[model samples]
Target: MKLPSPLYTTQYGKAYVGDSLELLDCLSDNSVNLVITSPPFALQRQKEYGNKSQEDYVDWLAVFAKKIKRVIKNDGSFVLDLGGAYEKGRPTRSLYNYKILIKFCEDLGFFLAEEFFWFNPSKLPSPIEWVNKRKIRAKDAVNTIWWFSKSEYPKADIKKVLTPYSERMKQLLKNSEKFYTPKKRPSGHDISKEFGNGNGNGGAIPPNLLQISNSESNSKYLRFCKIANIQGHPARFPRQLPEFFIKFLTDPGDVVLDIFAGSNTTGEAAEGHGRKWLAFEKEKDYLAASSFRFLENNKSDSEIQGFYGALLSEKEVEIRSKQSALIFK
Candidate 1:
């Protein structure tokens, strides 16, 4: 089906509603600048979100990866948030989600750039037969975010997103610099000048562990549930998760795509960060959910209280005109 043209463009830009795979097919190679998505997990356990057998799950995910590899620009990056699955009754992990996806992306000629651990402190402890039934707690967290690139070395602006060091670390580095002498130079080395003071952007680079929680019960997820007429997808990720990647990976006006647009959190985050977004959802309920969320968040003035008087009753058909009038006034 023909897709809708991009809606009104601003800092945080437009969202398209459709099937992601089909919409991706319509896009040209090297068209998108960044991609951030949390695909439904392939788990044996029943989930409110979609679930399938291992074979079906990998295959379903791989198909989208193939298209993503094609459309992503050479310098662009794709961040995938995947959670592991457990086998039935074993009380043990069976499948490694990242390992499977890494293999799939490698087969498609995408390079593994980096891996991030999203540490959700609020995660419920997983019940364990060995631990809970007999002794203690087993593994708790399940989610991981993988960074993939189309080339061996994709462009990344590391300095743009650097986090500052803690006070304790700063003191340690200061004390260590006095005794930390430079290694012996080669025979012909020109070791002339002393190094400058170590008080630059002090402390080590930020570790890959990202501490974020699921959206608050009243905000993102609740808003989505109200507009979409469906419960939030069980595996729906928080907006902050995608917001981090989009802001760090792409500049303003860059196009970001989410193939499995459950609740369209990626699109919402992209828009908030001033990037254009394209999202695909096959399920009608999902599409409605995404649209309702997008419109509610990006509502024009005509849809609000000021445009509801009797004088404007019959003139609301021209949405753009009413919006323009509201903007000018």
Candidate 2:
């Protein structure tokens, strides 16, 4: 399918500025390998980035989910990140995210592959009334991440996203025969002698819960945005979040997409991992500022200004890694 002209193009992806549903329409059926994104959450108070009220969010999202399902390959996965919200004037939590999971599976034809949770250690104390003032509830720092797939068995490899083994596990691997014994425990699971047999892969399979910090103070994207005097996306996710799923769910050269690309972090992660990517966002400033991700590191401030100026003028800019050349169309 031929897509509309993009606001800018990187070597591996195109960042389009328009309604995501419109961009999603241009994609051929079963074209994308993965769709990983954190759309605007259903929050009580509206954020600068915009969010829907809890009541209207699920139906609002289903419109796009249907198109997303059509574009994703049979073995492809849809990973959604939704933050929890509090009910208005009460300490009670909202179930909008859970409702979305049910609506997508029961109403749409998606399978609930697996559920993951993202715990941001740097997240501030929220719902000030309940957590800070009343001291009745703990800080809500976890976001529910639902992994939906068109097929029961999606294209995923945990080996690609393994976490480093702990020091105790490292020691056990080194002296399995001397320090360990094979025995059946009270839990009724028998431990075999080959339990420590990792074959020197150097990592263990990660758990469903992901612990990643969202601190972006020193990131190049933020630095460039500051230099260019453009406001960086306020709710930018850490690249690690998308990088994990991209590596786990897709092979090199496969297509990955983000329907609501904030700073185009998913696109940047896809580019680094050698995957073709597409990003769609309605905000022009955010989409244009995302071009900073593809810019050459050693570019001068004036060059950065000129590049951003061209994008603001609505000229098509193509970024090539070779000599950090900019090709205008």
Candidate 3:
């Protein structure tokens, strides 16, 4: 399959509206530096955007996994963001996410680089029948983010994704405490004297738990969609989710891809970090509206209309040639 013409392009990224499998086949082997995406969950019920039922989810996703393995460099990574789902009419949560992880590692010959937990505090109480009405369970807010690698050592720099120091640690640095007498802790662990001082870096290594809120009401993208009478993507990953991985797993000028870019948030984040990116989306309306995230807030209506027209235009021009009766190309 030939790589289709880009529907739209920014200074740092390209967005294609079509089957990702076709677009991915056009790339050279080991060309992508990182692959990051939050695919649709295999849920009990069918979603409007699209998703297979839980029974077929793992196999459906494995097809893409094999393609990802071929295009990623030996030191590159493939990060997946999958949320837990519930079994139909049952109180138990599904293990479909784990099933996919196993398929990636054991069957596809990939390695488990690390596991991350994304905690969305603003998530509404889910499985309403089991949690709200029955009062038998708590709110489900944590999602499993599995990071897989093609080799033992993937391209990861935790320093890039470090968080700010805690208040206590910041206070210690202000006190000029360079050395603490080494001693055994109450938990029977030895403490180092350098622990009193900072690691000399501005930020500390972040834990595996990522705290992010997905709620957005006043963003420019949403505002444009409301006025244009278009629905924004129902499931949009927080910009910071892909931003963190792109910074940690890749360097400037490296290529990144999002095969299932529902709203092209991954492209926006990659562009922000000086990385070139490619985004593939199947839904045309969502892809057209996703361009809003790339435009300035002061863009006029005509500019917005032109932006949409440029993406939708398939004007045909017929030429008279000796070898052809009629041609539209």
In terms of TM-score, which candidate is strongest? 2
Clash pairs detected, candidate 3: none
* Clash counts for the predictions, in order: 3, 0, 0
Candidate 3: lDDT of 185?
A: 86
In order of appearance, the predictions have TM-scores of 0.75, 0.96, 0.90
lDDT of 3 by residue, 192-288 (tens): 5436454546788888999999898778888887767678899998999999999999999999999999988998899889999998999877887
What does candidate 2's lDDT look like per residue over 1-329, in tens digits? 56779999887899999899888989999999999999999998889999999999999999999999999999999999999998899889999999999999999999999999999999999779999999999999999999999999999999899898788777777876677776888997776544557455658889999999998896778888888888899999999999999999999999999999989999999999999999999999999999888887888898888888899899999999777799888
lDDT tens digits by residue: candidate 1, 87-107: 666656656575565576667
- State the TM-score for model 1: 0.75
Alpha-carbon local distance difference test for all models: 0.65, 0.92, 0.84
- Window of ten residues with lowest summed lDDT in model 3: 315-324
Runs in model 3 deviating more than 4 A are 176-199, 314-329
The runs of at least 3 residues in candidate 2 whose Cα sits more than 4 Å from the true structure, single-residue gaps closed, are 186-189, 193-201
Model 1 clash number: 3
